[model samples]
Target chain A: MSEPTPHSMSETTSTTDDDETQRSTAADPADPAASADPTPVPGETGGKFGRYGGQYVPEALMPAIEELTDAYQRYVLENEDGFMDEFRRRLREFGGRPTPLQHAERLSERYDRDVYLKREDLLHGGAHKLNNALGQVLLAKYMGKDRVIAETGAGQHGTATAMAAAHLDMPCEVYMGERDINRQRPNVFRMTLNGATVTPVTAGRGTLKEAISETMRDWAGSVEDTHYVIGSVVGPHPFPAMVRDFQSVVSEEARRQAIETIGELPTDVVACAGGGSNTMGSFAAFLDDETVSLHAVEAGGADLSIDEEAGVAPNSASLYAGEEGVLHGARTKLLQDAHGQIVESHSVSAGLDYAGVGPELAHLVDEGRVIPVAVDDDHALEAFHLLSRTEGIIPALESAHAIAYLEAGTDTEAGTDSEAAGDDGGEPDAAADDSLGETVVVTVSGRGDKDLESVIEETAARDIDGAPDMSAFTEGI
Target chain B: MSNRAVSDRSGNSEAIAQAFADGPAYIPYLAVGDPDYESSLEYVEALERGGADLIELGLPFSEPIAEGPTIQGAVVRALEGGMTPDRFFEFVEDLDVDVPLVCMTYYNLIYQWGETEGPRPFVERAAEAGLEGFVVPDLPAEEADPLREACDEFGLDLVFIVAPTTEGDRLDRIMDRVSGYVYVQARLGTTGAQDDVSDQTAASLDRLREYDVPKAVGFGISAGDHAERIVAGGADGIIVGSALVDIVAEGVESNRSTAAVADRLEAISRELVAGAERGSRARSTGDPS
Candidate 1:
């Protein structure tokens, strides 16, 4: 009924807050409909990635978030107290830095392109999650925090965070969705072996989203003594930026190796996008490289469309078909309803079943700097067996989404409805993409040791090409 | 200090201050539609019948990170009962309660409502539906300008929380914009009932002595004893959420009738109201309680 003061579209923090006086300023009280190019000044923007990220948490958490924002600025950005230096040193010695970039001869010959694999699977916890986990746990130590909490969907992050917390000798508790705990039992055992308590979250499908909410609820009370090592780049400010900065070493090393090994930068850099930690990590250093196309492969679980009435997205392709909405603190591309309720997302791989993606990745996708593609369970399962057989590498089902895209490409003609290419039926998993260029870098985000049971059942259920004979598994592996 | 939220629409906005003017206000909260729409309306009206000075109706949000297990359960039940923002407005219209209603929820629902962006649409709908004010958990002072402006435009009060840890420049920022009341968190945690009233409640109330708004303490306040302690410690109002929700949950679990559950809620509300009044009597009569 009345015209309110038009919130300025630009970063209004510079006017309302005394920027020089303190770095612990709150979210901008002005325009949330951020402009096209959200500047990367965390201080001024309060951690917005082009209107996608900000502090959307309770006031009880404001002091804790502000303290974290201050710590992030001083330690992560400014390298205060030699935080970055020590972090890198521990990452190299403890977690194994500069994981090799191996050229895949079998995949290269099969695809007629130079396919290089960034061996993050060789890292200590067998995934890129440790990169951020170690960084956050270390940051907590510097901030005098005595305990650390993390949420996991696949147990990759949980195991990695548990390992980091154990190595740091800090008490750690991980919140795993009850369903994931039942599925990823081995990784759960590994976390327990690492001396971290795993708490099962039983709310709302018991997945990454619920686990994250549970962990945030814990942090709301225990913020003084504990640090929440958010496993992905999806949460509020400082988390997305901090986790990205920590995991960016994946791309930094890959970028250098691509130049040195290939004698030029690769034409494409591919990584699987879940909550988009690995995707953002692998794409961080390559964002300015126009020649290098960054492909973020999302899990198209069962189908691409959302069941609006049922409130279920049969896929986790937030980057591909999501609308902007807030889920876990940050406003990002999410598989939500028209009413802004976050719908349940599905994926054969627990890691990629999340409904929302990293805010920065969402911004990049909208800006045309990154490309998102979805691979269904059938194709991803085949790719898992293909990689294990061809290259002797059992890629995680989450990582297999990338390999599936590498083989089938994004042209939906090669989908389950394969009549587009006629009855002649092209290589079911080998639909070609000539634009992937001469050299391609795919990040093997994790080893698939944890996904053996799921892969066997999934591969057997669908007649996935290249799946190993299941006769021996008739009696159970 | 400026008495900004004085009311014209049946004195609804001014009713907030009046709720606390008599004595310590007994504010009880419940999800808008926990078990079902009809029963929830009965539960709220039951609170009014039981001597509730003010009421906080939770607009069920999917990701309520600020809530603990109890309130989170209530939100889930409410959402499962086909509760949406539009449905909540309709609920308010159907609800025949005289206690001033404050919508407590997250920022996304408010920001994403109606055709155009910002809080105007939701606040307009809320005001039109006879809501007095709002208590958005996620909308901090830094990100509170839009909501504040919209509330000011529609003559609804915008209340901010002052946590036990809140102080220094941040506290000043919150105090500058807060109206109707300041929700003083009794402890540093998510909202749910606790066994004992926090010792920090008195100290937090003392810290907010200079602010010129009704200071309602919430978080971990469950029993009538908590109300007494908080009110005796100089709190203007006591906000109880989880304890009442627990009764509803118990009623649903035990298969009690709507009237039975409503009767239990009314009894608890009376107990809480009496507790607060007792503390107020002690305060004014110079009793050393």
Candidate 2:
């Protein structure tokens, strides 16, 4: 039923015999009469539920992709013999699941706000990427694939997948962009140590996109022997669905924990959107809960808006400059130019330096299901230093962007007040400098072990011989 | 149907099958126009001497869907070079090459030729041209029956494709009446130079074998090395299209210095043809080992 063509990349299996006419949409989880829905909202194919996942590729690889998609679907339906229970057991006992939700007592009491941390950083690979990698590796094993191939940025997903593949004794190959190989040297070493062949990809841009290109090339060459374990929920058809299904446990657990602690889901759900895995995973389970507002904070480098007069632009703006097109063969929304060429995306965090988000997320933005917020680089650095000093959590710069938005709304009023009333208070110098008030849940995405130098340099920039003009740095935006 | 479009039915399909079944499979190519009509007649004789098992008579259409920029450009020039349906058939009717020939053209041109009886006039004219089959790149397997019926009446095979993406159901439809061989699209993206044959081609060939049809992969098969890969991957025939077009284009590029360019073209084409013949033997035997 699936027509895998260049234009139709995903494994689009029609539910009905007359399937060729209807475009696949995401399925709705709660609606029983979902098929009767007319429009494809962001999440469900029609109701923005779940039916929309498909593979669109060149005419060559349709059969293979269809086989895989059909296999995964069959596995999902038939493997009700406590597969998830067993998976949960393995993750909880061996790989470590239910990562603690830490109370940021310091930040909470200091500002009159309740700020808690979902410590995905404490998870095995120092980021939330491990959760999905573990799940995918399990899925591949169940499917009888002997080899695993993946592309990685910042080496977090690559290292985690390497660890899983090694534990499973599955031969693993990780494609890293030549640029990323240089930028994330430690992760590359970790992957090597974990018994993964780190293939340096020298293709277009030599970043995540190039790494993906190399991975696809590897796949096209060895489709029979390999299972392409994509890092995020952003590739072709089933990857976005599969990875999201795996990462859903994050929010599932969070929802349970939140309800047990506070009697209901949080009034506001916030996470950083790097390919939107953690953000979407954390917000997905509670999307239709009208009271629960979802906020995805993106990295805004020197400036949130990119204009000469605005000084510098924020890096986390995928849709702002992005157009709805295709990248890596899937027709989703992409950050492209008017001529449909992909544009280079910027973000202060290495994890966030991607040009495209998951297509479902684009649909969410289209249907107005989610609100995207961008935070500047300087503010993210300030947040990183503040979280580290005040809460003893060296939050990743990627995570710091979420923290930046928590204070972004206070930019103008707090800017004037702080200019008039300087940080002459009795607190650590770092926390005092970052004392913009807001009751916000900033996702501390990962530990900042990778960002020590950048943090040091930014902090060093503050001690310019004199206090110079402390008033200049008081704006919240 | 004009005289040019209709091919000679008289045992031509049986002859093509007989050639493949026996020894020395003939692989002849026809550019829309070469030198003059007299030269095209000479070219057919030249192909027969060169040991062509089956002749593929090129139909010069204005727009060829699967042709690369080079072939497309040449086709444009070939048209401007005074190749027409009437002129094309008049030349073909004169040539007495005993081998079976397949007429190849774009669907739009065939559609424009108008319909006669069941199939398009082009297929009818293909029978008049003394060809054995018709290769329409734009026509899908589902819609090939009209041409198939016409080709059957005229004793021409309506060759169908099984692209890399063709699933089992689609493959079944494609191989149901496929004659000559199931033409395989070699790669994704617009066809040009393919350094390495994609694994999808192998999968497509392997799957097509289930239907017991001979598989022939074409489009962007540029090198001698590519022929080896195609053969190794279980392809029954490797149709090298772009590389041949490049040779002819090179001849045009170097002015009308026919002897020099002809030497290069003949040498390359001979080497390629010989390799393809060897490949067909290897694949037929099912022992690349």
lDDT of each residue in B141-234, candidate 2, tens digit only: 5445667767766667777656666776656656665776667876654345566778778777767766654567776676656666677667
Candidate 1 residue lDDT tens string, A199-258: 999999999999999999999899999999999998888788889889989988887787
Q: Which ten residues in a row have the lowest lDDT in candidate 2 chain A?
A: A421-430
Candidate-wise lDDT, in order: 0.83, 0.61
Model 2: CA > 4 A from native: A1-53, A76-78, A109-112, A301-316, A411-440, A454-477, B1-166, B170-270, B273-289
Model 1 reproduces what portion of true contacts?
0.64
Which CAPRI quality tier does the interface of model 2 achieve? incorrect
Candidate 1 wrong stretches, greater than 4 Å: A1-45, A410-435, B1-12
Candidate 2 lDDT, A274-342, residue by residue in tens: 687878677665554434455667655554344422212245466434445445544455554332334
Ten-residue stretch with the least lDDT total in model 1 chain A: A418-427
Candidate 1 chain A TM-score vs. reference chain A: 0.87
Best by lDDT: 1
Q: What is the TM-score of chain A alone in each candidate?
A: 0.87, 0.78
